[model samples]
Each structure stands twice: as C-alpha cells, then as structure tokens.
Target chain A: MSQHARGQRPEAAPFTERTPRVVAARHLTRRQGRDKAGRFLVEGAQAVREALAWQGGQVHELFVTETAAERNPELLQEASNAGIRISEVTDKAADSLSETVTPQGLIAVCDAVPQPLDTALQGTPRLVAVLYGVSDPGNAGTVTRVADAAGADAVIFASDTVDPHNGKCVRASTGSLFHLPIARSRDAAEVFAACRTAGLRLVAADGYAKQDLVEASAKGELKQPTAWVFGSEAHGLPDDVVASLDTSLKVPLYGAAESLNLATAAAVCLYASARDQRS
Target chain B: MSQHARGQRPEAAPFTERTPRVVAARHLTRRQGRDKAGRFLVEGAQAVREALAWQGGQVHELFVTETAAERNPELLQEASNAGIRISEVTDKAADSLSETVTPQGLIAVCDAVPQPLDTALQGTPRLVAVLYGVSDPGNAGTVTRVADAAGADAVIFASDTVDPHNGKCVRASTGSLFHLPIARSRDAAEVFAACRTAGLRLVAADGYAKQDLVEASAKGELKQPTAWVFGSEAHGLPDDVVASLDTSLKVPLYGAAESLNLATAAAVCLYASARDQRS
Candidate 1:
C-alpha cells in the first residue's frame, strides 16, 4: 500500500491493489453460485440504495463508478462508514459488469433468498401472490413491487421463473424488492400443501374462471389467509396447480383482446384481496 | 429510376440513397410521419407479426434481414402478396434500425391511428381510460393493451403523455394498438370537455381518492358512459383534473408501499369497471 494510493484525489488512482478484491470477485452464473454464496448482484443506483436502506448490513460489497460516487457522495460515505467495501471502476468496466443499459453506475452484492413457506403463512396473511413460470425478469420484478404495494404478506415464485436476483428484476421492483419476503420453490404443490396446513384458502386466477374477482373476494367468501395463484400469459396456471386450488377467479373481459399481461392481472387480483381484507 | 438503380441489392453498396429514405420513412420523429402519412414503424418480428395479423393492409413497407427472411418466409410471402414494398438489409443495418437488442431482423412500416373517440363510444361504453402525463412509451403501450382487454371503448392520452406511435409503445401493445382507439389531446380540460359532451361520467383514479374502486363499481355507481383517468406515478392528475372530475376513486392499499405503478392501477380500475358493466 502506498500513501499516494490512500490519499489520492478523486480522479487519481486510489486503492493500493489497483484492482479491489471485491471488484475482482468471481461472477456468479449458475444456481449453485446463488445458493452457495447466499449473495447476488443488485445493479443500479436506485436498487442498490433500496437494498442498503432495507437490508443495511446484509450487503457484502459495493462497486460504483467514479461518476456515481460524485453524484451521490452521501451514499458512498454511508457505505464506507458502515465498513462496507467500496470500489471505483471505469465507466466501461461498470457497463461490462452491468446487465442493463444506463446502469446508474452503482451495484451492490447483497444477501437474499427464498424464505420458508411457513414463515410467510405464520401471520394472518389474508393476501398472498403466487407467481408460476413467469420467466421475464422485468415482469417478475413488477409483480414483486405490485405485491408489496397491495400489501400481500409474501410472494412465491414457482418453478422455471427467472431468478428474482437478476439485475433487471431488481430495477423493475422500484425498491419493493427489499421490503417484501419472497419464496421460490420448484413444486407449487408444496406451496399448496403449506397453505392447506396453515388453514389458508387457495384461489387460482384464470381467464375462464366462473367467479369474478369481486365476488371471490366478498366478505367471508374468500377464506382468510388466502393465496392467489397467477400464471404466465402464454400459458395459464399448470393444470395440476389449478386443480389443487380451492377456488378459481377471473377478471372478466369485455373486449375480444385475448388477455391482460401477467403482471397487470396479478395487480388486479392482489388489490382486490387487499380491498376485501381491509373492508 | 432505372431498374439497375432501383433494384441494386442493398448489400452491394455501403450507403444507398434509398437506405436513408427507408430509415427516415420508418422513423416516427415527425408528427406527419404518423399522422398525415399514417405510418409508424414496428420493430422486431413478434411485433411485426402482431401488426400483420391485426392490420395487414395498413403495413406499407417490410424490412428484413436475409436471415430473418429465410426463417420467416411465410411472413415475407404475406408482405409480398399484400403488395407491401420489401427490402433486405444486413443484420447490422437491422440493428441500427431497431431500438431493442436482438432486433429479430425484421421491421414494418405501417399506417394506423386511434379511432375517432365518438365512434368508439357507441353502444353504451361503460368503461374508458384516460392517461395523463404518462411519458414512458412502454407504460403507454401496456395501458393501451389493457384497455383493449378490459373492453374500454377508448383511451385518451392527455397532455405531456408519450406518443402512442413510438415503436416501443406499438410493440408493447402487441397488436392491440390496432384494436383500440386512443386519442391524444392537449390536457385534462379538453378531455373533460369531450367526456361531458358525450354524456359520460369522469372518474379519476387517485391514490388518495376517498372512494374505493370495488365499492364504486360494485354499487353500479360508476356504470355506463364512464371515463377513468390515471396520472403519472410521479405527478398524479393535476389539481384541475382532480377537481373537475365527477368522482375520484382509489385502489385501497393495505401496506406501507408508496403506490401502485400507473399502468397497474389503470388496469385494476378498468377491469373493475368491466366487471361492473358485465353484471
């Protein structure tokens, strides 16, 4: 380590290593990387800020561009003061490291994983969102944000869905990613079983369901501790998942358009249940 | 123009006079390109396919990479049979012409716009959506698609809103851009005037509105000839817009999350109104 490296000005090369260890850490690619490390990269200034605000000490490292640090000095200072490692990278390096364009030049490595299904059901969770096979990272992120806004107790991402830790998903969550508990499982049947054990009612949202969402959410009609299952737009909920549910609900369509986008449908259902629970 | 000059393969020259003309023709930077000329660009194959299925004759030109044409000969034949001008470009050219990564090697120049508001209001339109200051092209597009599915008679894009003809918006609409009538106007005042003239009730959707959506719709309180207004998530409907409405409705939220995304809220309200109308 050199004095020049430690006391160098903003534009000057600072760390002694030339390459910070955190910045040089191996990139995670497979599910094993996520499961083994218990950490994933959350990119963008807004998302990283939300993670810091919500999870605080849970963040392992912060990588930021010089421009981002200059733009948000307080954030950089906070990270440094909290004993979190910080590294400055070139714009090109940040771009290469980021998953989306216009990355906002900051990224955080943070700890997050699927919580146990029982933990989500422990409370009187009248509203829950179950996402099945939603592979688009942005849509998944939006659903998480929507679920949080609607005050759902938790969100369950079922099999074959995009990793919720993906950078795009974090950005699309608009900061809600940090505020909600999320559980991921390969088998939705297990989720149903947990709901059954917890004395929760399960409702599946289908385009052809006989009951309208309003009717399904009427007082005393929707069993308390409810879990609402939403499926991908291209394919409705898996037949088995649908069959396992106690009731099915639909948002009636007035026009000939095939269906609402998956996130929009989930928002509708989540808000409906939220309304019912509140009133 | 001589056949040699007109038919010179796009590949033979690095820059062709026709190339700029074609690119300019497909660009929507000018209002005349979308209005007087009644043409807008649809980038990517999935979007082009949706446009073709919904408004085939409205497509004036088809641009494709050789690879894309080889893979989708049926699409090529459909364009050719419809007398749409076809031009082949290199993958680089396609990339340059597209806004999305992985351009899908195809784009279409089409002619279409929102249907007249009056015509769309026929047959007792129970639900309508108004978008104010929603500058995000993708959000505007998703709203259009949702309005189509919810069977809303028309969508009004008020002041400061993004152009519905933006390529991303068109692509997001997934062909519903052609199915629904969307009107772009100066502000809420004009929208209010239009609604009043048409004998429709105006219901503005606000986060703090007193009435809950389900209650408003379930009671047949906001039934027939209704217009539902949604504002940007950043700056909600202007004070004037909120004050002049017949009623203001909110989607009840049960959590600490700030608010629902603009498009998501609109979809819920529209679907609620659709359900009310159906019953």
Candidate 2:
C-alpha cells in the first residue's frame, strides 16, 4: 500500500476487460470463481459503501471509470478514507464488470459474506428467515432485505437455494445484504437441526396452513423467538420438511387471489413477528 | 365461427414468424401492438384456462406445440368446446411466440382486459388497487394478482405505468389478469376523479405515513369501499397525490427494513383492508 497525499493518488493507466481485477470481477459473476476466490463483485455506490462498511475491510479493490471518478468524487473520497485500492478502468471495462443493463461505472470486489449454519446459531436468534430450495435469485434477495428490515437476527439459505451473493440477489437486496449475517446449510435437515439446538421455534410460512398469521400473532404466538421457514413461490414447504417444523402459519387471503408470492409472504409473516416482538 | 365437430377442428398450417396470428402474437410483445390490436398473448395452460373462462369470451385463438397437444388433450377439448380456434405450431414457432426463457408450449391470444375508469367506478367498489407510474411490469402484475386474491373489485394502472398485458407483468400475474377488471387512467388525477365520483375512499400506501395498517383495520377505517393507491417502488405516492387521497396507510415496519417493495406493500395494505372488511 503506497501512502499518497489526500486527493493526490496518481491515476493509473486504464485497464480493459482483460485486466486482472476486471477479469476477476467478471468471473465472480459465476459461482465457481466466487467459491475458489472467496470473493464476489459488489456494484453501484450504495452497495459498494455498505460492502466497505462491513467489518474487517472486505472490499479489496475498487474499479472506477474515468467518468465515474470525475462524477463521483465523494465515493472516491470514501474509498480513500477506507484505505481501499482504487484503479481507473476503461468505460468498456466498467461495463463488463457490471451485470446490469446499464453499468454504474463502478464495481468493488468484496469477500463473500457466508457463515456456517452453526456460526449463525451461536447467538440465540430471536427471529430468522429460513429459505429452503428457494431457487429464484430475486426472491432470495428480497427476502434477505425484508428480513433485515424486520430486524431479524439472520437469514439461512439452504445449499440448494440460489447463491446469496448472486448479482441479481445483491441488486434486489439494495445494500441490506451486507446488513446481517447470512448462513448456508447443505440441506433442510441441517437447518432444522440448527434451530432445534438453538432452542428456537420453527414456524412454516405455509399458504395452506390452518392458522392465520394475524390470528396467530394476536394470540401472542409470534412474540416468541422463532425461525420462520419459507419455500419457493410455486411450492410451499415439502411434506417431509413441514412435518419437521413445529407449526405452520398462513397469511389469510380475503380475496379471490390464491396466495402471496414468496417475498411478499415472508415480509408479512416476519413483520407480524417484528411488530409483535417489538410491542 | 367455424362449426367444427367436437375435437375435430382442422389442424391449421404451422405459423411462421410472418404468419398473421404469429406475427400478431409476436407483435403483442410491444406496447404499441398490444394497444393497436387490443389483444395480448396469454401463455401457459393455467393462464390460457383463465382467459377462456373470462366473461364475454376474451380468448379468440390458441396455439399449441405437438407435445402440448398430446400431453394436454383435455385443454384442447375444452378450447374446442368453447369455440376457440386452435392451431398447432412448430417447436420453433412456439418458441418464437413465447418471451419466456423456457417456452410453455401453450399460448392464447386474448383481448386486453382494460375497462374504462367509469366502468370500474360504476360497480359498487369494495376494494381496488391503483398503480401510479409503476414501470416495472412484474410489480404491476403481482400487485394486480394480490389485489385480485384479496377480492378487490378492480386493479387500476395509471397511463404512465407499465402495460398490464406486458409479457413480464402477465407472466408475473400468474393468470390473475384474466380474473378481474383492470382499469387504466390517463393520470393519477383521473383516478382521483373516478374514485370521488364513485364515492370511494382513497388510501395511499405511503411508507412515511403515521397510521399503522393493523390499527386502521382494528378501528374499522379500512372497511369502507376503498381504493388503495400505490406508486413506483423507487418512490411512493407523490406529495400532491397524497394530499388528494382520503388518507394514507403504512404497513408498520417492526424490522430494520426501511420500507417494503411496491408488490409487497400492496399485498400487506390490500390484505389489511380486506381482512377488516370481511371480518
């Protein structure tokens, strides 16, 4: 790390898509490289700021196009203060690094924030969102965001679920992905075991369940430290999986609409618990 | 209408991209075409069934891959009984007709189900969801589905909002588009005028509002014939729009989430009013 005067780090030559950092960032788009390298790409200013804010300086390098450097002096200032390595990248290179249709001209390579299921269970989690075989990256991200907003203790994504650091999930999370601990279990059995050992009640967010969310919450059932399990939007929890859970809660639908989607259902279920717990 | 024997409609020629109906279905991929033709493409078996079941016979034609025809003989028999023109398409042609990554092998050409604001207002409205400048087609569709599930009378989309028939919205609606009345207003002002004329209360789903959804439901404020107005996920109802509404309701966040996305917020808000009105 070279020490330079404030606002005086000499601009390095712009790198193309072939440059090591840009190549690395693009490769992080795939799970293989991400797992091997133990890092993923964080795009946009807000996500970058949050990634940098994560304890222990996870962001190793920042890539900025010349236009972004000129337009976003503040982000550069933040990077400088955080002692992050900054490099100038070609416009085309920045475009390649971003997964969005419109590149933000900035991207950061940050360490993947994955915790072992046991690690997440160490602290008695009051409220947790367990995603089992939830394949959609967007739903996975939104649920993480909702769980974070509801001030849940953690989110556990089963190994069969979409990668938590997938670009689409990160984008939908809108920086909330960095706000909480994320755990991955190899299977639903691992998650079930974890919650049991942690002494947390397991409640399934089932559309077909007999108990209504509001009714259950009003009766003081939701105030307990609980782990709320959700599955793919198309399918609720599997029969075997549900049988293992302590209880199943359904958000009562008053209209002709059949059921709420995965992300929305999780929001309602978690927020009910959140409100009840807070009150 | 062709008077064909039961299950005996002559197999029409395979439609190339240039063929009239295929071109029309493909044209529906654009907003202009959907408006000009006054029809849209409804894909998948579930959506096709819903469109056919819609009153006044909105579905005019059905296209099927040979595989789907063999696998879903009952759907074809039902289509024939309903007097729908069914055509067999090549796998490539079926692929062309679908916008999804995996073509569902069934597509129905149905009339765009937009009702006049007056028409929506004419009915004794109990519940409705209005989307203003919501550009995301998926969100628009999901909200419409949620509104329908909550048994809302109608779903309204402001002119600037994404077309309800847009491929993404239709896909996300999970066929709910055919299950209810959809009204499009030239602007939010027009929506306001319609609601006032219909003597319905307007409640904006605002994040910053002081009122909590549960409290409002408990007090019976949500039981009135109401129109729930939502805006783009990026921004809530505009200040001027909020000033015109009867009141605003916020789904209380006990979690750390700053606010819910457009789809999730509409679900919680609509259901709160729905539960109150019903119970």
Candidate 3:
C-alpha cells in the first residue's frame, strides 16, 4: 500500500472563487460548453457517488468544500483511492460550480455519459425508453430514473431532446443517470428503425390513441420486447412519428384528467411493459 | 338579457396595478392570507375555467387583461353568463396577481378546496390516495392529478401535507383540483381510521418492503379496494406511520434505480389498482 494517506488532509491551498479550473467547470452548466468540452459537471453527493462507481464513467476531478469533505469523507476517500484529482474549494468556489440554490458542496467533472444508439441497444432490449422532443430537463431525467427502476435496458434521447447532461436533469435523475446506458441521436426515424431492427416493437405513448394500456395488455402486445417512445408533455408524438411506429397506446385516464405528465405517462407505459414481460 | 353586450366592451378604466382589489387578490398567493380569507387564487385559463365549472367552487371574481380578454372572449362570456364578477385589469395589475414568470392573463379567486376527511372518503370508494406529510406542492399536486386520472374517488391530504390550495400545487394539478373531492386533516391516524372504516385497505409504497408489487399482486391483495398511502420522496413514511398501515409493498425495481419519484410510484400503484379492479 502507498505510504501517504489518501484524502487524509485537504489540499494545501483550497480552490478560491477566482480559480480558473473552477471557473471553467461552471461553463458546463450550458449545453454549448458541455458539447464542446465533451464533459459535464455532476453535483451533489449521490450523483458524484454514482459517477465514481460507474466503471465506464471517467470522473476526472472532484471539487469539495471543507464542510462537504467532512460530511462525505468516505466518498472522498473512495474518489482519492480511485486516483481522481480531489480539489478542496471554498464555499464560494463550490457555489460557482453548482446550479442549485443550495449546492450540496460536492461536484465531479465527468465525461459525457452518452454512447452511440447502436451500442446501447446491442443486445435484446426488453424494455427501452425513447424520448423524442422531450425538452424539459427535469422530465427527461425523471424518465431516465423511471426507466432504470422499470428494469429498462437503455434510454435513447432522439431529436431535439434536452441534453441528458443538463444539471437539472441530472439532479432530477437522482443518480439514475449513471446507473444505465444512455444514447442520443438527432434522427428520430433512424432511432425508431434501429429499435425495430433490434426486435423491439415501437410503442408511442400517445394521448389520443384509440387503444389504451388495458386493451394493449388484453391483446398481449405489452408482453413483447418494446421501445416505449414518449414526446413532449405539451405536444404528444408528432403524427408522422406516431404513424411510423408499430402502434401507439394511451395511458388510460380513468378520471377527469385530460392527460398525464410526460414522465408520468412514461412511467405508466414502461412499468406496464415491465410487469407483463416479467410475468 | 337586457345588457347592451356581454364582454363586448372593456371596462371604461381598467384596474391599475395599485388598485385595492388587485392588491388584495395578490395576498391570496400566501398561505396566511389564503387561510385568513378562506380563499385562494387559481391562475391560468385552464384552472380558472375549471373553477368556473365546479359546482362546489364559488368563482367570486375574474381578473383579465385586455389581451387575454380578446383571446378568450368565450371564456369571458361564460363567466359573464355564470353571474361572476368580471374585473378588467391592466397588464401590470394582472402581473401582480400571478406567481408564474409568464402570467396566463387570467386569475380567479375561489373558496379553499379541502373538505372534511369523512366527506372525502364517503360512499363505497374503490380507490383513493392518502398523502401523508408530502410537503412538495409539485409532488402532492401531481399525485392528485394521477389519482384523478386513475379515477380515484378522492384524495386525502393527511397531517402536515402541503395545502392543496398552494398556487404551485393548483397549477401543477392542471385543473384536476376542481374535478374531484379533496380532504385535509392534521391527524394522520384519524385519516387512516376513516379510510379503514370506509372499507378501503391501506397500502404503503415502501422502498425497503420485502414484499414487492408482484408478490402483492399474486397474493390477490391488489384486487380489493385500497387506499394507497404515499409519503414525501426525501423521507418516506415515518416509522410509526408505516407500522400502523395495513401493509406496505414496494414497486419492484428491475434496474439499478434506488427508488422511484413519489409521483411516479403513485402512478404505478394507483394504476395497478385501477387495472385489477376494472378487470
């Protein structure tokens, strides 16, 4: 074992608000900087812990405040043992690296967490979520978390969806972002075709669809491999997109609600498929 | 019928930002003001419309800007026909009444929405949602919407649960607030007892439950009338609260997610009851 204790003492000089590296990390809050740098910032202890545990994730650096360092000593020790550069920072510097009102005082610079669609769907994907035009970062991240909970194989973000690396999305995901494979594409049609070729039936969660979850379940359509496609909450899947799918089914609204939230609908559809497929 | 023309002409002088009535209406945004006045503000067109439609709701006043009036002439006419007071207000006055960044140019003051717990759980209720200490307005409201969508008979806001009349909660409910019965109480045990007396079984969605949804389903537990009790997402049902419930079952997590969001889990649980009961 190495003689020097890891994460035993804070860095001799903690990073200040004016630190250039900390300043650079702040830009990851925006999409342009994240895309160009091929990296993003993961804030809060839970997400940072997930990033550190994910074998495929490259957590290059960790920024922590004195209070946070004490609060999460085990996580810091883990990061130190993994050879990740641990930088001590002042509260102001921690604030600079966070987008939330109350920063959890921990952040990690990670490689973008997405891979190619083909790579994500390589094997037989029994349950997958394809978010098309899901622009809300919170909804997108919530869906990612829901998909993971449903035992989904992968989540494909296609065509104008919010960047999965967005801070709000990551926070809303509550560490589920790092738990599963994520893939992105600009061409939604190609993504749908790829899903079909992978032997997963495309089922869009359309609000206006004639068939509901019960009917789909009755027909035994939900038991098969399915890639559940969801669109924006404001606008359901585009007519052209819905037309191209194998079929579309609506989450039944038994009461007076006109429609379900995008994440809510996705949870219902994905869990339905999960229940039937597992049964 | 003798009126010159309904909603055809704007008031001679629209209420200014400093108008006393407009100033008074803004106070409804706060809990203290809302509680003191026994009234709350419902913003946006959809909610205002729902308030207009609800037989139980008394839409006391309607505030509208010129632009919104022009856009929704029919809604104004409907309000006019309903004998509700229509107050034309300046854009500045409308802005003063809204909490959202983009005001929908419509706001309605209505009576507080909660009723007695016994009244909410009245009748042979097949399904219901009991939110205990769910303080997040968004989560509580979304659960209310989900409960409505699943055709639950009522939603009981138990104990320290957020006031369902909170502006964010009302907006998040997307007008479902007016579609169903809502009950509130400071005593959670009373709420549980009332639910049990109503012939509804209490099922808590616990993350650490040894019994999963599959086992619960296989045991024919879900087929009966049930009141699904959910707690806050951050801290689940308190130990004492969970211990008092009939039984607790967790949504089976097929993937790596630690837990589902409160609303997501509620949707899955409520819809499961809907499925079995309907079948």
Candidate 4:
C-alpha cells in the first residue's frame, strides 16, 4: 500500500456510500450476512478502539468520516499502524454503516469474536454468565458488560439468546464485548456440561427461588466456582432448565417491584459471587 | 357515562387515530406535552395494569385495540369497575400512540405521579437512588426499577435528568414507576439537603472514587440511612456534585471493564446497603 493510503490522507474526496467495500460492510448489519461473511460492524469511537486493542479480536477494516478522523487521530493512527484497512468515507457512507440514530461516523468491521463454548470455558473458570432465550439485543449486551465488570471468566450466549455480535448488543456492551471471552451455543445442555467440566457450579438467578442472594452468600455457596444462568426477564428460567441447575437463588426484592430487569439481577448476583470469592 | 361506553364495547367501531381524545393522548409522546398536560402515556398490558392498580396514581383513561381488549378482558373490566375511561381504538390508532416498533395495543393516560422532593423523602429512609444528568430514558427507568427492587425508599431525578414519565422511561420501569415514590428537582443542592435533613448520608456512586462498595461495606459505612447519587455513565458525576456528597464509592471492576453501566452500578451499591443493613 502507498504511504499516503496507509495513514491519514490530506484533504481529498472520501469514498461515497456507493463504494463497494462500504456496501459490503453495511451487510454486516444483518445476522445472516454477518454469519456468512464471518464479520460484524462495530460503531462509535470507544467500541472501535476496543476492537483495535483487543488481542483476541481482529478488526479487519476501519471506516471514518473526515470529521471523525480529525477528532480521533490517535485511533486512526493505531488502526493504520496495525496494518488494518482504513477507509475514509463521506458522512453519508458512515451513516449507512451505522445503526444508531446518531451515527458516530467511526465504524470498524471486525471478525465475529465469539468462540465455541468449550474453548471459552477451557480454563478453570471461577465465574461465568450463561444467557438463555435473552433475545433483546440491549439486554443481552448489558448483561455481557455486567459480567465483564464483575470479572466473570466468560459469557455464554446459549439457547436462543440474541447474537452478541449484533449492533445494538455491541453498543450496549460499551466495548466489553472485546474485553472478555464470549461464546455461543445452540445447546443449553452443552453449555452446562462445559461449565461443569470447568469445575463451575451452575446457579440459576431465578426470581421465584426460595433461596435469596444474601442467604446464598452467607451459606458460602458463592465462594466456589459458579456459572450464573439467566433467562429473559419476561420469562424466567424454564422449569426444566432450573431443575437441571444445581441451585437457584433470587435477588431479594426489598420494595414493591415484582421482579428485577434481567441485567440488574445478573449484576447483583454476579457481583455477590465476585465479592464472596475474592473475600 | 353510558353503560355502553363504560366497559369493553362489543365489536363496536373502535376509535380512529383522528379522534379528539386519541390526538390528545398522542401528544403525551413528547416531553413538553406531558409537562403541559400533567399526564403521561403508559403502554402495554403490564404498565397499564400497574397504572390501574396504583392507589396514589390516577389513570385518566385507557385505550385498547380490539384484539388487546379481547386478550385482556379482566384488565378492561377492572378499569371499568374503577370508573376509568376505557376507549377501544383501531390498531392503527394504537400504533400512533406507541413508541415501540411492535405496539402492545394497550395504553393508559395517567397523571404524572412524581411528588415534590420534600414529600418523597418525608419519612426516615434506609436507601435511596438519586440520578443527576442521567438523560437516557432507559437508564433512568432501569435505575428506578432496580432501586425499587433493592427496597430503596425513593428515586430522585435531579438536574437535567430525563423525566421519569417519559414513554420509554415508563416502559423501561415496567410498572415499577407506580410501585414506589419518585421525585424531581431542578436543584441538586435541594435534593442532597432534603436527604440529609431526613437523616440520610449522601453517597455518590462515582466510578473513580477511592472507596469501592466492598470496602465501604467492610467498613460498615453502608449500614446506615444513605442516598446513593449517580450521574450519566457517559459523563460520570460532575466534579462539584461528587464533592458535595458526604462520601463517594465505586463499584469495583473485577475484570477488564473500565466501568459499570449506571443501573448496574446502582444495583450493586443499593443491594450492598440492603444486605448490610438487613444483616
């Protein structure tokens, strides 16, 4: 590649929305396209930065508008130095590649980063979050972020959960998607088998469970290696799934709310384990 | 009111989008309209049910699509028994009043239920969540829901935060809005002052704070009447706001995540206090 093409170029007409590569990147917006192409789009400066910085993730290309390039020269410089393709695109082109109402004008096309379940759970995992039937992109991603924050070993998207590589989920993860080990599986039993094989106890965060978070912690249950299973807030863990888990514990509700949002419950449960294990 | 209009009208021509009442209810989709009308829209079966159930709240009217009315006869019957205005609307009319892509076909016009700061914090309180400059409707509402679940005494939307009555906020709260006390304030100073006067310590949930939740709880600091203040995750508590609080504590990031989402952070802090105080 020419030196001029490798880094920030001098003022020139950027590629338009019609650019062939831009058109290809836009296809990553859909799940099937992402699956077939083995890539997904990451938007906004923070997420793009994480993509570039992630050792486990590969950011194949970077697209930035002139204004975004000006505002984030360091990011562009990093992308350029990493031998990634950096395409300077027009504002319209950036908009085409974005999913948010307010496009940040910085988008990165990265490899779909989730690994196979066995690979993600390979180590002696101390804490994990396994999601089942969580189809909301935002909720799935928020739970991933909380899992990362609580220092869980990995996050498993299992059994009909939204694809973590989906745009909204990636945005809601706030770059945590690139910071942790993520895996997906069509089989719930396999996910449980992998976690158990990794020496992690399975605990379902069920709202109706007689055992509460406080009691679980007090009983030294959270001190062990554990995988906290969660279902969508709209529908709690299926009875059969709960029956398969070693135990189920609810986050104690002190107020009148009948239930907690899925992500909130995950945060409370995962952090309780983090604290107990560390203490 | 005529008996025919009191409850679910059997197969009658449903109200169209242009109907006068539907037009007025549609206005509640915007913030200014809600402020001017002193009412807001609650959509979907879950929220509408809570609006009808709230003793402290007034459900001014109920709008239901024909299918929604059929699916939720008990909800409509309850509204009728309470003398609430129940208007069946066309599917198109229901869509016009909804913010979500898939309209739930149930809507309730309810009085804006936030009380004054002084009134909301009137009694002695063990836990509270105060949001300052939290502009995202989802985040604001999610915090409210978690606060309620943690048994927080109240939620205070202070200084540039999104109105809790926002349609998206109400939907995110998932009926928790009607379950607890909520207050709004233009003045952050007054919010802190009120909590202090009510014998509550002011704790800011600052990501950059020197003290973390586990350390705070270990020190027995969380076992007291406290109001945990939070700011937007994008731009954490302003420096001045953090300084004014009695103490600031961070939720420890056990993993590579730089910080927790606002609601996630609040959940960890509030639940810690709940456990500590209860223990």
- TM-score, per-candidate, Cα-based: 0.81, 0.91, 0.95, 0.92
Point out the higher-scoring one by DockQ: 1 or 2.
1
Indicate whether candidate 2 or candidate 4 has the larger lDDT. Answer: 4
The local distance difference test score of model 1 is 0.73
Q: Which candidate is the best by TM-score?
A: 3
Best candidate, DockQ-wise? Answer: 3
lDDT of 1 by residue, A65-184 (tens): 766777777677777767777777667666656777666767777886467788766766677888888888888888888899888878888877788877677777887777877888
Grade the docking of candidate 2. Answer: medium
Candidate 4: tens digits of C-alpha lDDT, residues A133-205: 9999999999999999999999999999998888899988988888888999989998999999999999999
As a whole number from 0 to 100, the lDDT of residue B235 in candidate 1 is 86
Error of 2 at A188 (Å): 3.0
Worst 10 residues of 1 chain B by lDDT: B1-10
- The lDDT for every candidate, in the order shown, is 0.73, 0.82, 0.89, 0.89
In model 3, residue pairs whose N, Cα or C atoms come closer than 3 Å (at least 3 residues apart or on different chains), thus clashing, are none
Q: Which parts of model 3 have CA positions greater than 4 angstroms off?
A: A1-11, B1-11
lDDT score, candidate 1, position A168? 73
Interface RMSD of 2: 2.1
* Residue pairs in collision within model 1: none
lDDT of 3 at B206: 91
Prediction 2 TM-score vs. true? 0.91
Clashes of 1: 0
Colliding pairs, model 4: none
Kindly indicate the candidate among 1 and 4 with the higher TM-score.
4
The 10-residue segment with the lowest total lDDT in model 4 chain B: B1-10
Candidate 2 Cα outliers beyond 4 Å, as residue runs: A1-8, A24-27, A118-124, B1-7, B24-27, B92-96, B214-220
